[model samples]
Target: MMLNPAQARARLRKLIRGEERVFLFLDYDGTLVPLAATPGEARPSGPLLDLLARLCTCPGLRVAVVSGRGIADLEKLLPVRGLYLAGVHGLVIRYPDGEEVWREDRAGDAKKRVEELARKLEPLLEGKKGFLLENKSAALALHYRLASPREAVEVVRRICEEARPLLREAGFVLRTGKKVVEFCPARANKGEGVDFLLSGWRGAFPVYLGDDETDEDAFRAVAEKGAGVLVSGRPRETAARYRLAGPGDVALFLAEVLQDRSPDG
Candidate 1:
């Protein structure tokens, strides 16, 4: 069953148990900030960033931003201290310890393909607007959110068709997200990152809150250890056990957990 806002808040509070060994796994774009037509516009508010900055002080509350963006992009979005992050769907992991690891080609290696595909895609569709190319490590995302509703669907289909053969030839996998389609190396996935994090995690509980299909792998991985909450209901084959309406609900629930000191909390 799904949780109402209050219940969800209460439930989250109970999970923390003041243990503080919270290995937080979070999605960046839609989870931290509202989804945008382009990745450039999806910026979190300063206050939210400040809140995260404060949480950095919570002892044992280790946080990691696991997302489909590249390492550089993740760095740009989050400059807070004491946070561990993995980008490009686990392809790149950047730690506060000044270590960076990659599961596939680094951002530099994929630049040529990223540039070439962006150029190729822009010319293919006429009278279509709002297509964006986001280059992650060994991955490329063609976002069509700025396109018209009808045009968006067509853009996705055409781009997928155009990308399929080339991606496979280069040994990549194709995945979809809210108004976006991506091609990435098969080595990078949320499952691998989550499992890897858990291998070193000494937490009694773990939670993953994501709003997209790409998050299903993480959801499945954490099912036995904790819970994964879905933030969308747009017809996905999810392994999530719970769902929420949108990002606002996510903030509200988290804020409540931060404030709660009840017996249930």
Candidate 2:
């Protein structure tokens, strides 16, 4: 069963009260803001920015945005300082102090292979209305959220048929999310990213909030030591122990976290 807002708040407060440090990991697109038809349309609002800034300032709390977007794109979308960013599903991690780390992949030609895949897929999707080919440097995503249902089905079929062999040869993986399919390096995933971040702060209480299939790895990563809050309105099989209705509820819960004034707060 999912915890309601009040229950979630009380539970979190108790956890925060016990921990010496708290680490909050957030997924960008669906968790922090509503999912947009296009990636560019999902820019953060001023209030959300303010809320994040306040959370960063909260004592004994650490904040990071772990996203499928590249670090450069995340930097543009979320300009809040003092916030760590893990992009390309944690292939790249940037610290609040501007230090950055790139996870080494076994495939030395991964970038070249990714570029070639993009080149091959672009033409396939170009004329298909509402199909967007988004190249995020380290990964390529085919967005069909704006396409008609029939068109979406056809596009996904074509992609899987055409791209699967190449992906297998290049050591890449395909991930499906809400109305989109992503071709990314096989070694890069949100779980490794969450584990990487958690490694830096020993004994910290960690809480992650996300709303997609891609986030399942992260949910499992923190399952033993922390809480994974799934943000969705509908019921589904998930590893997450808690759930919030939507981004609006997420903001309210975050506000409660910021307002808590216990000794560790």
Candidate 3:
């Protein structure tokens, strides 16, 4: 059962009411900001940053931007203080206190393999317009959002076929999103990242918001401890306990939270 806007807002308010500790795990693209034709065009509004900063300042509340983007990229884009940044699907986590943690020590080899796969896929998608090969250093994403449906499907099939052997040898896994396919390290996922971020905060509740299939793992992770808000215009098979229409709705929800000055209410 997906929650409507009013119901979802009321439910979220109740979830955080009088809570001593809260953790917010938010996805960047498509959740905080609308999905852009190119990744570079996706940018959060200035007010959004101010709101997030205010949220971070609230007592006993910790906020984290957990996205598939690289840590450096996220740092450059969202310069909010007093927040955590978990990048590369949680492969790397940077704490607000200047501490950092990484999942594996063999990232060098993994990234090389990912680049190799990208190279192999380039020729396969040679003439396809709007086919973007994004290398996040820790993962590779094939974005065909602007391509025609037929071309997207064909590109995906050919990439899957050509990269199978490389993926096998590197023990990598493929994750599908809205018109995008990602090759990531098998051991690192959004779920594991959420767990890592929540470790030792046994009593604290979590609220996760995401908009893509890649976020399903984080949704399931938060489901055990708190709630997951799926930001989509339509209902779909999801582990999220609630749903919002889109980024506009998400901003409104955050604004409500910001207006609630009392943290222990």
Candidate 4:
């Protein structure tokens, strides 16, 4: 069962109050900003950027944005300094000090396989309206957000069938999210990213916020130690213990958190 917005906020506040340090793992799309028809259209607003910057400056608080976008794309989208970014769903991690780590270093051939699959998928999407083949270097995403539901379903089925052999050959995994299906490296996931981020910070309470199936891994990762907040308007089965209506509610909640000063203040 999902806890209501107020209940969830209160619980998070209480947890933060008790903990000396807090780590936030946030999902970019559909969590920080509303999902747009195209990924490019979902750019973060100035206020949201400001909020993140403020949070970064807050004492005893650390922030990381974990997303399926590539490191370059995430850096372009979020220009804030002192942020830990996990891009390609954790395949690449960028630290606050500008150090980058590629978790999938041994997957060189696997990446080639993904590119090959993208080439095979290009012609299939040539005549299809509203189909986008996004090659993220280490991953490939087919987005059909602009297509009709029936059209999207048929296209996804066809793509999956055609890509099955390549997926198996590359040992890649398919993940479905809001109007998108991604072929990613088997070991690349948000859970591993969260675990990696948390490993350095002992005794820090971690909270994850996300709104897609890809985020489920992260929810489970933080379940034993902290809380997972689901950003959705409708009820659904999820591992998240709390719920917020949408991006607007997320902004409100974040603002409230900033207003609630730490015990030291």
- Best prediction by TM-score: 4
Across residues 46-155, which tens digit of lDDT does each residue of candidate 2 receive?
99999998888888889999999888999998889899999988888999999988784543476788889988887777678998888887788888899999979988
Q: What is the lDDT of candidate 4?
A: 0.88
- Residue 226's lDDT in candidate 4: 92
Tens-place lDDT per residue, model 3, 145-242, is: 78988877877898888888899899899988877888888866898899988994768899999999889999999897799999999889999999
Please tell me which predicted candidate would have the highest lDDT against the true structure.
4
Better of 3 and 4 by TM-score: 4
Backbone clash total for model 1 is 0
lDDT of 4 by residue, 1-265 (tens): 5678877887788877777888988999999999999999999999999988888878888999999998889999999987999998887899989998888866677668878999898888878899889988789999999988888898899999999898888888899888999999888899999999999898889999999999999999999999888889876888888888888988887876676643423
For model 1 the TM-score comes to 0.86
- The clash count of every prediction, one per candidate, is 0, 0, 1, 0
Model 4 clash pairs? none
Better of 1 and 2 by lDDT: 2
Q: List per-prediction Cα lDDT, in the order shown.
A: 0.74, 0.86, 0.87, 0.88
Query: Model 1 Cα displacement at 261 (Å)?
Result: 10
Which pairs clash in model 2? none
Worst 10 residues of 4 by lDDT: 256-265
